[model samples]
Every structure is written in C-alpha cells, then in structure tokens.
Target: MEEIKLEKGDFRKNIAVAGLGLIGGSCTKALRRTKTGKIFGIDIDSGVLDKAAGCGAIDDGAVDAQAILQKSDIVIIALYPRETIEFIKDNAGHFKPGTIITDTCGIKEPIIEAAIKYLPKNVEFVGGHPMAGNEFQGFDAASPELFFDTNYIITPHDRNSGEGIRVIERLAALIGCRRVTRVEARAHDRIMSLVSQLPHIVAVSFANLAVGEKDMSVFMGRSFMDVTRVSVLNRELWTQILEMNNSNIIDRIEDMIDILQKVKNALSEQDKNSLQILFDNAVKGKRMCLY
Candidate 1:
C-alpha cells in the first residue's frame, strides 16, 4: 500500500464523504471547520448536495460517486449499515489505489466483513463509530459541534495499515472528539449491544407503554421525557440495526430482564431494603461512568 502523506494540523488530501445525512453532514461540517482538506460530498439527493455546497461544508458534491472516489484520498462512508456495504460493492472498482475508506456504522463486524470481502485489496477500510447523535435525523438537524467532547471508536482489522489507523485517529481529534479508542470489531459490536442498542430498546418500549395509557401526556415530566426521547427513532433504520445485531442485543435483553425481574420481585415482596439497595447501586454505577 502507498503511504498517505498527512501532516499534523494539515491534511491537504481530497476527502470524499458519501451520504450527507446527520452523521455524514455533521462530519463534513466538522471537517470543513478544520480547514485542512478539500471536502467533497456525495448523496443520492441533489437538493442535499446543493445544501451542503451552499453551506460551504463541501468544496463540491455530486450524485455520482465514481468520479469523487477516483480522486479522493480518504472516504468516510456515513450511510446505513446495509447501504454502506452496497455502496462499496457498487463502486469498488472506482476508488483510487491506497484510498483509505472508513465507515460510521453502528455495528462494526458486518461492515468490516463487507469491506474485507468487497473492496479492492489496495483500498483500506477502518471501521469507525462516532458515539454522538440525537434522536433527530437528516442534514437539517446536523451540527458541526455534534462531535465536540464526544467519544469516537475505531475497530481496525489486523490487515489494516498503521498509518491508515493514525490518519483516522487524527481526523477524529480534528472533528472535536474528546477520545479516540480502538477495539476489535466483534468486541465493538458486543459492547454497542449493551450500551447503545439496549438503551434504544428500553426507550422505545417505555414510550410505547406511555402511548397506551390515556392522559399520559399531561403527566409527563423531565425524567419520563429523557427516558423516552430516543423512542422517536427512524423505524426503518433501527429495524435494520436491530436485525443485524440481534444476537448480541438478544443477550443484552435477557440480562436486562433478569435485573428487572429482581426489581419486580423486591416490589412484590414489599422489601424496601432490597429496593433501596438496588437504587443505591444504580446511583453509584451512574456516577462511576461519568468520565
């Protein structure tokens, strides 16, 4: 593989970002803020391309990605998991040799597999996930500051070049990530199932419970709202996410159920002592996680 010439605080490479939705758009905006490289945007939506260019988040954009792939030194794919795979498969032939391709997919294992199988041998793929986002979706909801002080995770394969990993780490820092850590792809997915997927499941289920209760809206408070905020999920996107990572998520769900069962049993037995202990443990756990 050819070496990518990237210097500290200076990346003059042509960086093409495929998919200009929330994560992608926010990434583009953050990259533009760095003023380190020429950023190009790609989206199926012509209007989105215009909006991205109009905001100066991109030097240029196009619906056709082949042209951009040919010239780009780095490509950040921000499409959905399946779409990301398909995009690579469809455009595998066009990427320039030594182009470092990475993706912002929620689950890393499948994306890593797709990259290894479909991409050209000369093309490098680093699996990445930005642990930052809101319930909102699309470019209109994206903010350049979205990644500020957020955590970014990279899951690199053994075949990946060391420089390619370093380049992504630097990009994460430039985009305002407070920390950039690397983990194995399978471990990354399992961890996301516990921290990310389970939370969404709980939020959506709780929200649905509220929906079933008449007059629930008037009684809603901050705690309830906070717990259910992410329930306003993109169903299509989440369906795919849940399906793709169902095995891990299912294990997490069972673990959650066991905990909930303990809480239920304590309440049923009118054991105030057990309830207090459980609440205290939860409080301590929350405090411990505040790094």
Candidate 2:
C-alpha cells in the first residue's frame, strides 16, 4: 500500500466509465460538472453510449471497452454484477498501471474477489457503492445530483491500498456525497442484504401479490404507492443483484419470515399481550434509529 499523492488543481485526467446507464451516466455528468476530468463512456449497447453522448454526459463515447480502458487514467464500472466482473476480466489488461478502478456494484464481496483474482496487481480496484438511486434505469434517468447528499460506502479489502481508498473517497466527495464510510466487503454485503436487498424483495413481492388479485386497484392508496414505488425498478438490474447476493439475501429473508410468523401466531391466537410486546419492541427499536 503505497501512499500516492493526488495532484491538486483541476483533475484533468481522463476517466473512462463502462456501462453508460444511470450510474455511469450520472458519474460522467458529475465529473463534467466539477470540470475536473474528461469523461469517456463505454457500453456494450451502442445505443446506450449514443444516448449518453447525446445527453452530454461524456466527452466521448465508445463501444470498444478496450480502447476506453487503454486511454483512461481512472475507470468507473457501473455495470451489473456479472457484467462488471466480465468487463474487468476482459479489459483489465488494457488499463494503464497504477490506474484507479472503482465500481458502483450493490454487493461488494464477489466484486472484490473478482478484482483480486482477475485484475492486474498494478492496477488499483477499490470497491465503491453509492447508496443512491431512483426507481429508474438507463441514461435518460441519469442526474448529476444523483449522489448529492447521499451516503457512499467504500468497502476496502486488506489488499486495497490506502491511496486507492482515498481516491475513491475523494470521488464520492466530488460527486457531492455527504458521507463516506469504509467497511469490510463481507460486512457491507450482509448489512445491505438486511437494509436494501430484503426491502426491495418485499416491495416487489407486495406489488406482485397486489397485481395478481381482483379488485386490487380499489384497495390501493398513497401508502401502497409509497411502499411499492421501488417495485417499478428495472427487473433486469434487480435480478442480477438478487442472484449475485442470494446467500445473504436468503438469510435475511428467512429472518424476516420468522418475524412474520411470530406476528401471524400472535394475531391468530388473539394474544393481545404478545401483540403489545411486539409493538413496544418495534417502537423502541425505531426510536433508537432517530439518531
């Protein structure tokens, strides 16, 4: 872990972002807004790259990932879980030595493992997950303010260099994230399973159940809309995330199911005492979250 000094002044280095969808497009736009770097976008879909260019999200767009990697000082991966690994394995050799690489993957453990196993030792691959997104996808949904006032988590492994982590932290700050927290990859995945992945699963399930029933529309209200808002998220993206973090997600799901069973039993037995106990515990736990 060498300590590399970041140059002060305008960060004019060329940044290549793979996958010109919401996350990549937002990153490019944010970097451009900072006037810090020249942004280049790469996507497997030429249409997405074209759209990103048309939106002025990047200085240039290319379908050839290797070419983008060859010219980039930093590479930001904003692809799906499997695609992110494949992109790194496919184009990592093309990256310049000492180039800083980061990703916006939801889960961290698998990505970090892939980076360690596939990427060149000289290139720095830091795990970054910006805890911000809308229920939309594609370049059209991108906003420079996507990361603003958000919390960006940097999951650094033992192999990660301090300088690499700092570079990622600075990038989060540059994108206007209010806080950056460093944690282990496994910790990140586990916590995210409970907080993000499980909630999304519940939301999708609720939406699916509601849609399957007759007269469901008549029962819908603002509360339903607020709860299931993320149910409208791109299924393809969510499928990737759910499958990638299946183990942790399944654990959380089982825990939630157990909790639900307790509630069901208490209600079925007409146990007001048990119901009150559960309600009290819920309120106490929620109160602790006020901080």
Candidate 3:
C-alpha cells in the first residue's frame, strides 16, 4: 500500500457496481457521466441491466460477478448487508489484487467484519454506506441526482491501505456527495442503529398500531403521515439490516421503551406537568437538529 494520490485525471478508472437497485443504479448513472473508464453493471437481472444500459446508466452489464471482480479497479456493491457479506465471501478472491471495493450497505460493523475475514489481503474492501435513497425500490425509481447534497459514510478497516480510503473519498465526492465522513465501523453501526434503523421500525410500528382503526388513513394528517412515510418499506432488505445491527438496534429500542413507559405513566396519572415536560424536552431536542 504505497501512497496513492488521486488527481482530477485519475478519476477515470474501470468501475463495476453489483446490484442495480436504487443506490447502485444511481451510482451507475453518476459514474457514467464522470468516469472516463468503463462502467459495468453486474446483476442477476438482465431486464434491469437492459434498462440501465438502454438509458446510458452503464457502459455494459454482466451477470458474472467474477468477471466484473476481475476487471474493475473498483467495485461498489449495493446489496443487502448479509448478501454483501456473502458476495464478498464468494467473489473477493476473484478481485484483482490491489483493487479497491466499497459498498452501499446500511449497517457497517458486520459487513466490515465479514469482508475482512474473506477478502484477499491485497484487495481493499472499505465498508461504506452512502447516506441517501428514499422509500423507493428498484432501478426505475433511481435518479442520477440522488447523491447530490447527501452524506456518504465510509468505515475503513484497520487492515485497509491508506490510499484505498482516499480513493473512496474522492470517488464519493465525484459522485456528487456533499460530504464524506469516516467513522469506525462499530461506531457507524451504533449510530445507524439509532438514526436509520430505529426510525424505520418506529414508522412500521406506528402503521401497525393503526390496524384496529380501519379508516386511519382517512384522517391522516401531516405529522403522522410524515413520521410513517417510511412504513412503505422493502421489508426483506430491512430485515437483513435490522439483524446485522441487532444489538445496537435493540439497545436503542429498549431506551425508547423506557421513555415511552414514562410518558404512559404521566398520562395515566393525569400529570399535566410531567406531560408538558416531556413535550417541551422533545421540542428542545428537535430544535437542536440542523434540518
């Protein structure tokens, strides 16, 4: 791992992305515009590859993971947390030595742990989570501009080369990310468990609570709707994510349960002062947020 300095001209490199769903498709589109080298879309779905290719999002498409792994200087895997691990386990040996790899998976520690276990020493597998995407699924919903103004988080393994991480940061910037922040893998997972996974759980739970009310949607207001919008989720993908960051997520949920019990007790006791305190604290906490 010698010092690898990236220049504006060095932005052109053979890049392959696994999975062409929202994040992958968006990356394909963005990279196709910015990178001078070949952009390959690797996936099992020929239809998706065709769609991406037809729209100029990818230079070519391949179903063979090894083919892409062997050819690309960089690989961005946009698969589920577990699937990303399995993919690396199966294909990491096939990656050209010195090739840099990254992912768009939500949880980090598990993926980073699994990657380090399986990836070849010469290959750089930097655990990454591009902080973007919406409640949408599939390539059709992908916008090339999706990464614009969004944060990208990268957790480089201690075993990873310094140069590889720098390349990833520059690559993130080239993809239109407003900021790229590096965090320890465990810390990244811990924060994502509270900020990202817990919200989805809350949104889905909120929707689940409305089952008894058949016309709950009829009276839906902005606040409830806004909070539950992510309830329209890709459950399978999220199931993997929740499990990957299980311990951290469970800790946060336990904290939530504790606070909720306090709120419930205040309501049951008809304690206006206690209820007002909770409401005021929540407002103050929220006001501290940037957006």
For all candidates, what are the clash counts? Answer: 0, 1, 0
lDDT, each prediction = 0.90, 0.86, 0.87
Best prediction by TM-score: 1
Task: Give the per-residue lDDT digits (tens) of candidate 1, residues 4-86.
Answer: 34366567788999999999999999998775668999999999999999999999999999988887999999999999999
Report per-prediction Cα RMSD to one decimal. Answer: 3.1, 3.0, 3.0
Show pairs that collide, candidate 2.
11-36
Superposed model 1: Cα runs more than 4 Å off: 1-9
lDDT of residue 28 for candidate 1: 94
lDDT for 177 in candidate 3 is 86
lDDT of 2 by residue, 178-240 (tens): 788898999999999988998888888889888658987788899888789888767777888
Off by over 4 Å in 2: 1-10, 287-290
| Distance from true location, Cα of 44 in model 2, Å | 1.9
Q: Candidate 1: RMSD over Cα atoms?
A: 3.1
Which parts of model 3 have CA positions greater than 4 angstroms off?
1-7, 270-272
lDDT, model 2, position 122? 89
> TM-score per candidate, in order?
0.95, 0.91, 0.92
